[model samples]
Target chain A: MVRVHNLFLSSDGYGAGEGQSLERPFGHANPVELGAWAFGAASWPNRTDGAGTRGLEDYLVRDFHRNVGAEIMGRNKFSPCRGPWEDHPEWEGWWGEDTPFHTPVFVMTHYERPALTLTDTTFHFVSGTPEQVLERALEAADGKDVRLGGGPETIRQFLDAGLVDTLHAAVSPIELGGGSRLWTSPEELDDRYHHDVVPRPDGVVHHLFWRR
Target chain B: MVRVHNLFLSSDGYGAGEGQSLERPFGHANPVELGAWAFGAASWPNRTDGAGTRGLEDYLVRDFHRNVGAEIMGRNKFSPCRGPWEDHPEWEGWWGEDTPFHTPVFVMTHYERPALTLTDTTFHFVSGTPEQVLERALEAADGKDVRLGGGPETIRQFLDAGLVDTLHAAVSPIELGGGSRLWTSPEELDDRYHHDVVPRPDGVVHHLFWRR
Candidate 1:
């Protein structure tokens, strides 16, 4: 089964910033504190003797990383490039050489661009409906789990299609008064997502949900 | 200066997770990986020259620890305590004897609890409006910058009040499908935040945003 996982940051009640530039996206207060708490798990090398992190939070990060074979993200995540792809030719994979995603990354964009093959990962731009991208992702993932790495519209499309099976949501303690909304209402989800909370050493919370 | 900062993970759409419990709160994809990262960073004694950390991520961590005189968070952040004060009593800080917020932490809660004096830090619960909390935070912070520790609601209050002057939001590559929305559409602000993007060797984007 393809396990579609969506990740995001929480603003007070608004969608993310209008221009999701690399510089400022709702201005996170403490990136280090948040990062240490959120990603300070197994994926990165542990400076400590594997102490301090909550067991549950560590489990979720590992589960997502280990299970994910392929990822599909909207063009917004791939780059700040918008409008026709021809306008911005300098844009490439956000991660210069060593991207976190070692597997294949499918970018959902309207513009046509050549596939980018990096040292460990490749970026393939997919046009058309999100379903098309998911199809490509499934093919790329083979039997492994496919993650619907998103930018809101992309994940909503997947969720609307009833594609995601499991989701792990991290609720950071900060809110952007107004920018973006994760889910307008729970009804958007066809069925209830099993919910659980995983605490982190940095005082953040991770909410996990999976379809029954 | 009192520096209010917000830290949280993004759910593919800038929203935080919900029903944060012991099971899933912080975005830990893998348990083992999460453990290793936490342990490594927590093993502060072992971090020699911080050379082991990958690139900008290392700098971001170092910067977080280096800066900030004191830390402040909400009641939810201090402990998993719920309901009125009587419901949950005698709750010590989360880190036991050696809490990470070695600096002073001013927790905002309705119930009044005795101050917790730990080995390296002290926990004081302040019950009042956001302004009152800010005053106490400023006093506690003294000349040093005050870290606005989280639990979304609290951070939102501070941000809405325009208490945060500088924010360093590290946009991790992962996405959470659904949870708590950090920013919503209704809330609006006119302040301009400046940012500088620092790419970590690990592909994490460290965005440092400051208000001019």
Candidate 2:
């Protein structure tokens, strides 16, 4: 199954901003507010130190990587570089040598780059249709589920192609004013999915959608 | 205090549709789905037959009229005739003589029309800014709260003006592909209000906002 887990969105449905740069990945949006829930969750892998919240937030953060074997992301999610990749050969990525995805990670971009291996993670830059890239990731995932780690545009591509089975979105109680919108209305996917909303006291609502 | 109650929106934040007409109050969108929660609530005064759901939906529906003594709406919401009032003399409104709003209803418009009284409900066609109309409505409301009955644009006008004290929106699971958007994100109101999300088993999430 292709599942989108722990994707944070502003109340306006924006997953990221328009001018995502190396300096401002979310473009004027405070990155801290966007993913504040996950950051405050004790189970976030990046939180090796004493940081994050407990309970549902922590459980959800911890559940993000469970039973996942591989990941597919947009090149933008991998790095802020756009158009061609030759301009920034020195840019390894936002993540250091020890990347989060321990499994094979395929990055979709028009510009092709050679595969780079870091620890258990192997970053493979590929240019193809969502289906073509999914095929490779599914193979790498073996029988396990594949995770769609995104910058919204990548996840939207998979969603538009009807390649997603499950999606979990954490909607923060803030507006970004302007950014890259995910779904204009989740009802656009109603033909293929059943939606459930889970509300929490922290002012965030968990919108879950699964294939009907 | 001005309160907006029982306003329902799609997950995308559309409260009504564009090109609203008398035949289609919510434009191309299904009016039933947009306000389905209110229809199924036992508290809905319009529900003559054994319709509406029990519990929270009913409670919220019943709460719509609790302290409301008057209503403020845009001209389009009162009647389908756009541009001028003289264009449609025969046109009363989408609601018949016995309109749902039993109190003095102030209709904001550019063209002025004499006040039309029907039963306990009186429709006053007045032209003024949000603040000006609000002044009249507040006076007519006496000591009770004034209700901001909307068509999205009207509610947004009040929201933008920072006049609404309490806002309750029921987000239906269904989506209207195209319509008038309510908030780019509820977070736009975060500067002045606190937001709360309450999920109901009916596949609708109740979004409550109040001035901080």
Candidate 3:
């Protein structure tokens, strides 16, 4: 099953705010604020100080790599550089050095490029519709479930196509007035998915969904 | 202090849906669905069965009338009938026989009419801006706190004017595609108020706000 987990969505349904640039991947949004629950969790994988709280939030952060194999993400998630690869050839990605994924990472892009390996992760730049991309990711996943990495629009494309199997969207309390919205209301998915709102004591609500 | 409590907001930040009329007070939205948490509570005063569940929701329901000496609402809250007083002279509120608001109720309307008293509550059809209406409500509240009763737009008016002191907005998990929105995002009020999101064990999240 294709899955999405630990994704932080702003209260206004934005995966990332407007004005995205090389300096600011989340655009006008402060990623630290939106991912407060995850950043504050003791189980956070990338913690520098190694000091954070534990509970449901910690559990979510720790569970980020449970059973995911190959990961699929949009072009923007791969780099701040937009358009063709010639615009910016140097693409090390936002995740410095050793990236999180230990499997093949499919970067859905219009421009194709030779697969680049960084530490344990391999970045494969490919172009296709949501279906085409998911098929390639699933093939690379071997027997493990393919993870659908997102920035909202990527997930939305799959959602509109009814290709997603399960999803865990963390609705952050912060709001961005204008941005790319995944949904006006989550109820839009009720026809195809069963949603369970898991409210953590820390006030971060996670919307869990599975195809019905 | 002027407070707004137990106000239900859709996942998209709407207070009420479109197509509002006498038959549908909340427009296309279901009032039962919106008030499910409170209505299901054991302490719900309006529970006819005398049997219900307990917890934070129950506490909020029972706390509804506490220290509330008066209520300020939009004309639509008083009745679905719009336009001048000539449209619908029979202005009995949607609350039925004994209204929940025992305190003096100020209904802000452009077309003013004589005050109507129902059982323990008195509905004053007053005209003025949000500030003017609030002033009258505060006066009617005596020494007790005033409650800003809303239908979404009403609360937004007070919010825009910075007249609201405290607010407890219940963010329901359900989503209504469109309606009267209190906010595009809860963060809009962060400039003037400190907001705390209290998540209930039952999956409901309440946003509590107070002037900084």
Candidate 4:
């Protein structure tokens, strides 16, 4: 089953802002504020510094690592630069050598680049349709489930193609004035998926969608 | 404590649909589906029929009568006809004689008409700015909170003018492809209000906004 876990969006359903750059990966929006809930959750395995909040957010955050073998993300999520990567040849992504994915990470891009390995993660730039890329990710995952990481546009492509089986979106209280929108109306998902909404006391709404 | 209780919207933040007429008050949208949560809630006073479901939806529905003395709504909400009412001269409103609102109901419209009294509810058409109309509604509400009944545009006017102190919107899982939007980005409310999100398991996300 293909799943999207802990994808943060504004109250207006925007996944990311416009004109994203290296400094502002989420464009005009604040990534810190948009993802504050997950980072603050006690169940986050990546949090090694201080104690995090224990609640629904923590439970969801902790689920990010369960049974996930490979990740498929957009080129934009891999690098802020658009078009060709020749201009910023030295760029290795915002994660540097400490990329979060321990499994194979496939990046869908128009401009292909050599596979880059960092610690336990390997960034592979592959160009294909959502199905084609999913095939490669699934093969790389062996028997494990593949996670569809997104910057909104990539997730939208998968959603439009009906390739995703489950999606978990954390709707933050803030609204991004303009940017790429995930969906104009989520009710459209009702045709293929069953929707569940869990509201956290801290002002974040977790929207879960699973295939019916 | 001006509060908007049980206001239903699409996940995209649409309160009502475009080209709303007497035949379709919610335009292309289905009122039964958009407001199904409230109708099923056990606490809804309007539900005189059998029993309703108990839980958060019920609690919010019951809160509709808490301190609400009077109601303010747009002319569109009262009647389907726009511009001059001369074309649809006989249109009294879709609510018929026994309207749900038992309080003094004020309708803001350019076309002034005599007050129509129905049961405990009286529809009074008045023309003024949001603040001006709110003043009258507040006076009519007396010590109770004034409920800003809407069709999206009307609420947007009040929200833009900063007349609304608090708003509670239920974002249903369904999506209306086209309609009047309540807000471009609800985050703008952060300047004067604090926002909270509570998602019910029934696929409705309840957005609570209160004056800071």
Candidate 5:
């Protein structure tokens, strides 16, 4: 059984982004807080020796990282281009050298592109339906957990298909007037999901749930 | 101006219960890890006591709490009743003698009920539109800030109205198979929203955005 995870950032009542620049799409909350909940222990800037503190953030970060084997992300997350990022072929990702994802990453896009190899990560671009991308991700993960790194649509597709396993959500304290929403419909959820609330000192709450 | 904040729980893809009861809605992630993020000096829990560790999580939590003057929640969060929580009328909130939201709390529901008063927190039930509820909350906040707690619909109304000020979202590592959809449309956003990304030790990422 493969576990599918979806990660996202939310606003108070608004959407995620303001301007169209990838540099600051979500606003200034705290990268450490966001990454801690998604990447877990792997969030540490230096995997080798960073002299980081060991606490709740570290524990959860490590737990999530330990479970994931491969990742699937939307083309927007993989590049800064708005539509058909192919126009600008040189743009890669916001993360410079030594990107956090040390495993294989699959990017979902409509345009075709070759596989990209960064420091310890390899990004394979797929041009097809989400199911096709998931199949490739599962193959890459090899029975390990697969993560859905989303802009929005990507996670919604997997979620609508009932393919997700566990969900961890960190609710930051800021609110966007509007941009892109994180969730879609509530009626779609039956008895399949559970809920927990973890309040952070930064006013963000960490919520987790899994399949029933 | 009154600021509206939204909060909720999500799961991995499989739709598993967060294993949350009225007692623990946060589920069963490592307590130590959660504590690290929630009880840091930056958060409200530690600012008065200095009980938790100091890190990025703490700082962000502190920033979130500092901006809040009051809170507004849906009837579901105030009580555990799902379809017709008012029918039972026996259930109250999970918070015991001393509830967390020490400030004023306005609950939106169709049923009319008496106000709930804990030590420092007071729960007021409003049976009007979200705008009315927000107006009362803003008055209660007294020129401070107001938070819109969630069931989902309540947050959606506020988002649709473009009444929120700042949004802080924590992207957890897991994905709920199904429960609540965060975003349904992209046109809901205006130019007032700004997003920033905050990475954490765990795979969680916190996105902070505010209305300008």
Candidate 6:
């Protein structure tokens, strides 16, 4: 299945905030507030305390990389660099040498670049429509599901093309006045998916959708 | 306390749909879809079945008319008629002869009209600002809490003035592409109010806000 997991959104439908920079990938959005749920999960990969909350959030946190073999993301999500790859030869993405993904990562960009490997995760900068990108991602994913990572517009394209099979969007209570909006309202995907709106005790509403 | 109860909204933050008219008070919004939670609740006054779901939603349904002694609504909510009183001379509003509201109802209008009565509910047409209207509503309430009946813009006025002490906004899963928006995000009120985004099993996310 082509899936999107743990995509956080604001009540007003903004996925990320405005004024994104290399220093702040999510722009003006307070990463602490946005990632609190994931950070507190017992299964959180980056948890330094050794113990965290074991709630439904923990289950999701554990499921983040369960069977995902490959990841696909928008170009902007890959790096803050907006121009040609030549402009920033030193930029190896926000993730350092040892990246998160254990599988191949496809970065959808208009300006294609040769495959670059940061330890285990190899990034292939490919340019194509949603279908073409998914084909490459699916092939790279092997038998497992391909996780579609987003910066909002990327996921929107996949959703619009009906290429997405399952989507798990967590809406945080905070609202960014302006930003890259994921959907005017999530119901826009109702025609193609069966939706389950589940809310956690911590004021976060999770929208889980599966293709019908 | 000045309260807003069961104020339904789309996921996009729209409280009511666009092009509201005499026939459709909520414009393009489906009343059945919007009120499903309340309609299914055992405490819903209008429920003919007598037996409905006994959940948090039901509790809210029962709480609807609790201590609310008076109601303050925008003129547009009172009547869709944009012109003068003469145009809607015989229009007794969308509510029938026996209006649901048993207490005094205050309708804010630029062009005032004499008070009218329909069974137990007395409709009082008054002109004033948010504070002014709230004061009148509070006075008419006679020590009881006042209900702020809205069409979105009316509630926005009260919110802007910080006149609303409590607000209960139920966000339905549906998305109205465009309409009268309640807030860019529920977080916009976070500065002055403590917000709780609680979601029921039926997919309705209730945003409860109380003045801090």
lDDT of 3 by residue, A32-75 (tens): 88888788766687877956653345445765676678999988
> What tens digits encode model 1's per-residue C-alpha lDDT throughout A1-212?
45543254452322354545556532333334334444644334233455333223333454445556799887876876677766568777556777778889998878877899888788998798867778888889878878776665667677667777666555555655544355753334536554434444445555555564
Error of 4 at B119 (Å): 72
TM-score of each: 0.45, 0.51, 0.51, 0.51, 0.45, 0.51
Clash statistics: count for each candidate: 83, 5, 0, 2, 103, 0
What is the overall TM-score of model 2 with all chains considered together?
0.51
Residue pairs whose backbone atoms clash in candidate 2: A40-A52, A40-A53, A41-A53, B40-B52, B40-B53
Cα displacement (angstroms), candidate 3, residue B75, comes to 69
| lDDT string, candidate 5, A137-185, tens digits | 8888887888776755666677777777656556655544455555633
TM-score of 3: 0.51
Clashing pairs in 4: A187-B174, A199-B199
- Would you list the C-alpha lDDT of every candidate in the order shown? 0.57, 0.80, 0.81, 0.81, 0.59, 0.82
Kindly list the per-residue Cα lDDT of model 2 for residues A139-201, writing each as its tens digit.
999999899999787899999899998788889998877777777666677788876666777
lDDT of 1 by residue, B21-40 (tens): 54444423322322232223
Give the per-residue Cα lDDT of candidate 4 at A124.
91
Docking class of 3: incorrect
Q: Which ranges in model 5 have alpha carbons more than 4 Å from their true place? A: A1-8, A11-15, A25-49, A184-190, B1-212
Q: Residues B119-208, candidate 3, lDDT per residue (tens digit)? A: 999999899899898888889999898998897999999988888877888888888999888988888888988676666665567787
Worst 10 residues of 5 chain A by lDDT: A1-10
